[model samples]
Target chain A: MVSGIREMKRLPVGIQTAGWFDEKDPAKSFRFARECGFESVDYNIDTIIRIGRDEAGNSYSFMDKTDEDLLQYYEPFKAAAEVNNIKISQIHAHYPTYVVGDEERNAYHIKVMERILFVSRFLECPAVVIHPTKTPDRGQEREINLTMCRNMIPAALKYNVMICIENSLKRINKNVVQAIWTDVEEINWYIDTLNAEAGKEVFGFCLDTGHSHIVGRDVEMLIEDLGSRLKVLHIHDNNGTEDEHLIPYTQNPGNKGMGQIGWDGVIKALRKMNYEGALSFECARGVKLLPEGARREGMELISAIGRYFRKAIIEG
Target chain B: MKEKLLVGIGSKELLPESNLEDNLRMLKECGFESVIYSIKENDLKMQANRHVYFGAFFKAAKNAGIAISQIHFKYDEEIKECNDYIESLHNALHICNTLKCPFLVIDPIQLKDSVQEKEINLKIYRSLTPVAKKYDIKICLINTIKCAGGYHQHAIQGACADAAEAVWYIDTLNVEAGEEIFGFCLDTGCANVTARDMERFIITLGSRLKCVHISDNNGISDDHLMPYTQTLGQVDWQGFIAGLNRIGYEGALTFDVSRSIHTFPEEVRPHAMKVIAAVGKCMRKSIEAES
Candidate 1:
């Protein structure tokens, strides 16, 4: 076994095979990741909240959700991280509708993020990420967005968790249409405007690889412009049109993974920027679990990319 | 190992005094090829490595030769962090894959508090389907009613507060999406109130009938006792098991007598497993005779 390029030493590089981080697999997905030798992962907050509840007791979800009146379920995550030797580098919180919209829930959201921050700090994670929604059509959606965000900034300030907003990728979902304003130009404008208005670096964008692909944004180009300002990346591959979040360096049916945008170049750009966070496994491919010594192809793919990062990018 | 049917006794079954491996060995000896394993809401983190608590159970299962067929994630975790849960699912799926178990059962997370945030729920179903498909493990949602306590009396409300609507909604979404990834675990006790149809629900669920959690309750409430205990709700136990037969449900029928076995704490769990194993034989004979 040619030991992974020695220079690849602790690049803080991670992959998103949920198995290594989680117990989520067909018994096969884990085998693929482990056999391949990648040991980091990211997960959905919902799984943490609903995994073991009776019916009426599950009032807690990861997203700062509606009517935030319930108990918190953060221990599962703390325990899961410890088991896998995986650290939660970023929270990847869902839309904080309750926090941004309601003041009380806003306080709760901050407290929750702060709590996650305590864990993230232990994990040495740098950020807590989320997706953005268009404001409800009250008087001013922008105001609601800003007002809700205004409360959110303090939470980020208190916790060491940098709050980042991600673009929604449900191009076909009519329901999300109202809360959608993720055109790249509109996003850059949103970032600049929000910061200028707040006069603080309170929030940033999470580059959702699939969403950007859906919008036909060149991954490399987005990296170049958004690099320094951006706070996170929801990394995964997809067929060009639909957001079928697939593993990276591989192409989906209709579109080459990353579409016309070159995967190699995108990685090169991200490497150039020295993005030290997670290349979160936001998609699914074939996965498995096994009795033992299981093989994980996804981990192999991630390891391959890690090698590329170490060899051509880091060395170069 | 043939994919045997089983149901979780609830992860809260993990008592401090419980000998994880001892009970697991008993589970294997009793011929339980499947299990609906769970973790407490607070213990969801520790449940992952499984080795922590079940290191013995896992090793024993391997040694005595049994398969962990199903998973009942009975704890509460964040849905938005589904990305992380997917990771956990990967591990759960790993167990299923390890045993070649066919199905994995879970509770549908209601992140959005109301019947209103249907879209978020839909997003969740859609999001996890890919992983479900990738793992080749059948993922199902279990409906349940919490036995609430008060100064006046007691009751069992459907799992997740109005799960019937949500399960119907999300299942429709997944089915419409042509994704067979979402299904129901169909707890005998939980179905008392939340199940859409006692007979038709199981029959229609057909192959989607992954696992059936067998428990009983008084007509007044869900007691989760052994069969012949409850006469409540709309479920026909004999017919429901028949429904499992009708739907061709080949998964485990986990006998969750957790409350009953709580004191013994893994001691009599296998004895209970033996009783359930007998029940499994009846089920197999009944189904095979019918077919």
Candidate 2:
């Protein structure tokens, strides 16, 4: 007898750990995520670093730990992922990579990122999402981010982790406007330039659906432009005017079909590109706003939505 | 256009029943310029001293400097068979007049039989028109969705779920009344549940659209989640704002996200209200800017 059913490709669905789960307890966090129907997680390593000043005006962070100690500190997260059968698909580096005119702070951010890349390798994560710097001058913004990425090249190459540059937004005059890497051409240029500098494909793009929507960038077109260079995703929704980081499809005002993001077009574009990355949710606000007891239900709903997207992408 | 589109919230979840004055003050502090006074059946049935009860509520709202944008009249299933339901509606209209609210949003009577559904709702709305007109209030029919098996089940089209049918209901009622008395309250969450394209619905309704119950949801259920806070792409907020802009909507941007608000801890509810008001302000700005 011959079986008639063909096997289907199952895409890994993931969620971020910053606001949804207790990151201090990696064992519980990974287990809870797996229980909530997630197969992967975008480890929010940014929480480990403290960038602001203390009461004494002294900056401090977990980045003060030695390389070996930091790796040991995160060893349990790796073990927990293995035990729960969850993949650490990606790690998010601390942001604001270049604070304006603050050389010491900017240097500290670079040092933190380098250490994070090292820890990401220990966690067996494949990608690290690093945000581009924002400045009033477009040229200065490019120079700052390019230099930052260039500085991370050695660590990225050594650890074999792809540095994923995410599209960002900036508030100008109380209005959100497109910032560094929001445009397809601008992002492509950054990825291409960084990869060229590294002598390999060490750079990739992490498309943030919420950020793109806030700045009125067409998600489908952005995905199509990034194509194979897109290695990760920060899937979330917004009302097109604010970076709310909401769950998909929840932003329609007055049920008037005024949703800023076109999710169907987004899924279709991802399908067309044959994107092979986890559908990771970066909707921390969605989970954070819910009461503690209701968070698991919220995560389950988000995971179910991911399954819907996965089926649509694979079958369509 | 900018002045007309003010941000507001429903009082059902955001305000504590015991401390109406303090809560209204909090709402004012949270940047809400208007509020939809959610009237329950009991509130309407308070009978002899109804004015005494609602007068204080109105006083608190006035003191807080918040406009009573509208009144949400909660409906019971047995409304068609009960004479008390009609009386309750009259009472609500009276309260609306007392509160100086311009619009009163009510759900259409949904009978199992479609013909009866239309007949009963028309009679009910027609009966309320005398009092509505006396109070100088517009009776607004909200578009609703029916969940076939129960909650969380697939939502199908309910009364006035279609734009043409909604328009027909309003126009027929107004024509019969010999004046414009009935308008529409578009519940965006209900539209999402029934998969109605809001832009088309709003455009079709045009000037008849008077009020809105702005909320978000996954298409499967009427979750009443905050706008821009649900599963991605389930609600089309862009099209919603565009439709409002196209129609030059001048009503307050009132939010009815009670379920979403209830999901927050009691202590966190105030902060959640702030976020809701902020989202409303952002939406109001978008609509006004386009206009």
- Compose the digit string of candidate 2's lDDT tens values, residues A39-140: 888888787676776787565688779988887888887899899988888888887777888887777777788888888778777889988888888788
Instruction: Give lDDT: candidate 2, residue B233.
Output: 39
lDDT measured at residue A293 in model 2 versus the true structure, 0 to 100: 41
Query: Considering summed lDDT, which 10 consecutive residues are worst modelled in model 1 chain A?
Result: A286-295
The Cα error of candidate 1 at residue B21, in Å, is 47
Tell me, by DockQ, which candidate is best.
Answer: 2
Off by over 4 Å in 2: A1-10, A52-59, A253-260, B1-291
Q: Tens-digit lDDT track for model 2 on B1-291?
A: 235977898886677769899999998987799999887787565556878878988999999999999999987545544577877888888889989899999888787899988988898899988887777789999998876875335689999999998998999999998899999999998998888898988999999999898987767667687765654435788889999999999998998887667654344455566667777777877888898
Task: Give DockQ: model 2.
Answer: 0.07
RMSD of 2: 16.4
lDDT of each: 0.53, 0.81
Instruction: For candidate 2, report its TM-score.
Output: 0.56
